[model samples]
Target: MIALPPELLGQLGTGLWHVFAVFLRVSAVVTLLPAFGERSIPVRVKLAVAVAFTLIVLPAVPSPQSNPGLLPLARLVGTEVLIGMVLGIGLRLFVLALQTAGSIAAQSTSLSQLLGGAAADPAPALGMFLTLAGLALAVLMGLHIRVAEFLIHSYAMFPMGQTLSAPDLSQWGVRQIAHSFGLAFALATPFVIASLIYNLALGVINRAMPQLMVAFVGAPAITFAGLFLLFAGAPLILSIWADALFSFTLNPLDSGR
Candidate 1:
């Protein structure tokens, strides 16, 4: 057995602890974020991923001084975890855009009540479609690579043991929440316009035939029409969504910008 010197042993211990801190932060983010972080994924799987990612990122993270005390170590770990959660939640906000758009589209088409397969949370059929589409688009657009780059850059932006002001974090969080809605509206714009036109025509038809069961008759027509519109406009919508996601993931500060 090769016995290491006390100094080398101390350095190795510090490095390992730092890596653990990074893992905790990343794991917290993935636990709550969208897609891979969804509740549907097993806890064990997430833990495994976090460990894997931490190993990958350890070489990139700067080394910290050896400290055996629990308080300092706890604080350092907390900061890393907070930063990780913030980044993860920021990416999650982009996914919310698609869900919001889907909800609006569903309501417009009178398909809001339709049961969709469980995704994230139990959502409507339209929401499910939108979520899947957004996820697939993000993956296709190299989200994983961009996310890794972002994680590496984050250490530079917010270094270990630095205090992050609560006010600033709150402001950033609020902006992300607002941006989620804005992105959703942008994605659903085409469907919104289509719904308006369809509703207008329905209104006129009802006026012309007062005895007609407009609700029952128009439901099927609107559902079919909405499906058709979704099919036709999906490509454009997905492209735009992917671009927005890429931009968001690359620039965390862009939520406010």
Candidate 2:
């Protein structure tokens, strides 16, 4: 049997502890990340992803204090988990923005009930489509690389074993939520405008020909228009959403974005 020296054993333990500490944070973040964190993804795959991120982030971050006491270790766990959740929730808001935009667009185009249960979550068909497309686009654009950097940068903003200022965090959360709603509204603007025009023209036609059943005549027209607009405007809408998402990833606290 090969007997390892006490010094080497101590070093090994500390190193493992450091990795565990980092994993705690990484796993929390991965639970709510965009493409990689979707509900459809397997739990094992997510665990592997968290490990991969921990390895990627390990070298960049400073090592945790070696051999902490039970109380200190528990404190560290809580702190790291909370920080990870805050960062993860921030990123998740962008996904919420897409979902919100999808709901608005779907309702505006009168397509809300079509395939509403397509996704794991109970959302409108358009919402499901946009969410899936946005996730794919985000992945294609090297979301993993940006997320690694984001995780590394998080260490700077939220240092090890320190509690964040609750007031500041709360304020920041509110800002992110407000921005998400605004972004959702902006993305759905085209559909909303089209709905408005359809309503006005329908009103005029109804007035002009009281004998004609305008609802029956216009239902198909509005549905066709919605489909056409989705096909035509999707590219632009996704582009705008992607830009906002990337911007948020780059700087979560940027209120102006």
Candidate 3:
């Protein structure tokens, strides 16, 4: 083998270190990413995706420190993992929001038991459908491209080897959770309104015609209304959800918004 120059070897080592550092964060994020990190996906596939993201993000980010001592290296590992987890969980929460909205809608319409276990997450069929559609829509709308930009931007928000402030992180986490629930409620508002109207009408009919079994008569009406609303309103609900998800990916660190 031809001998390599000392400078060339040193540069190679530095490059490898940078790649490794980036990989740590990328792998952590991929482990909890929305559709790409679903439990149903094979582990090998996830690894390939993480590696691909690392390569895409590497050039855009500032190079990490090379040749760190053992203690500093350990700290770097922990810091990167923590940041990646925070970011990944932020994206995952949007998926959870969609699930929550679907559950609420199903429960309101008395359709909660309709194939509830069909999905891997043990959610109602409605929830599973919404999640699958939302994920597919997100992917079709260039989710991968947005994710790459998000990953590169993250390096600026949480620099290499820097630890996050606990109090700030906690507050941010609270805000994100609140926002997620708020979004879910917003998406399920139509179902709730329909349920309320149905209940009121059922009560009036029962009082007006006590001889008639209002429950039997009202069930079909509510079911039909629920299905129709889903068919008509799904597009709007998904559009709202997609906007929120994209907004979050664009500025994950700004949880206050």
Candidate 4:
């Protein structure tokens, strides 16, 4: 049997440890990242993606020597997971923004409660359509590559084996939650306005013709209008969302700053 040099073996061990740390963080983040982390994807495929990304980011990530005891190592791994979750949860907010926008749009147009929550979330058919379309669009635009780059750059903001601040993380989380809801309401504003006008028109028409069966006429009109609005505004909506996602990917800390 041939024996390897101690130096080479030590180097290999260090490299493997760094790779493992990267894998922990990558896997955690990938489990929640947007298109890659969607319910439609298989766990094996996601794990494969995490491995691929770990390989790419290994060179850029710094490996600090630490106490290799079991308890200490476990704590480091847990910290990595927490960092990954914070980064991932930031992007996840954008997905929720889309969901909220869809819900509002569906409700305003009376298109709610029609599909009975076909998707994972309790969203209307319109919401489901918009979300699926948005996700597909994001994937087509090379979301994985953007995410990999984001991970590589994240080291600057969140270093490995570093202690995280609870107050800072909490503040960031609150800001992200507020922004998500704001974006959602902004995206759905147009639909809400149209619905308002639509309802007002229906009220006047019904007042003029009490027994004319306004439900029959108003329902179809709002439905058709909702579909048209979706068709027309979807591109703009997705464009805005993609811009925000891409921007955040490149500079994850800018939102907080």
Local accuracy of candidate 1 as per-residue lDDT tens digits, 88-182: 88888877788888998888887787885555476778878878877877777676677667777777878866778999999999988887888
Question: lDDT at 47 for candidate 2?
Answer: 96
Ranking by TM-score: 3, 2, 4, 1
- Write candidate 4's Cα lDDT for 23-138 as tens digits: 98898899899988988899999988889989998899888673399887888888999999988999998888898899999999888888956777677887787777888888
Count backbone clashes in candidate 3.
Answer: 0
* Decoy 1 TM-score against native: 0.91
For each candidate in turn, the TM-score is: 0.91, 0.97, 0.97, 0.93
Model 3 TM-score, all chains together? 0.97
Candidate 1 error regions (>4 Å): 1-3, 117-120
Residue lDDT tens for model 3, 81-197: 999999999999999999999999999998899998887667987788899999999999999999999999998888888999999999999999999999999999999999999
- Model 2 residue 225 CA deviation (Å) reads 1.3
Per-residue lDDT value at 24 in model 1:
71
Off-target runs (Cα >4 Å) in candidate 4 are none
TM-score (C-alpha, index-matched) for candidate 2:
0.97
Cα misplacement distance, residue 26 of candidate 2 (Å): 0.8
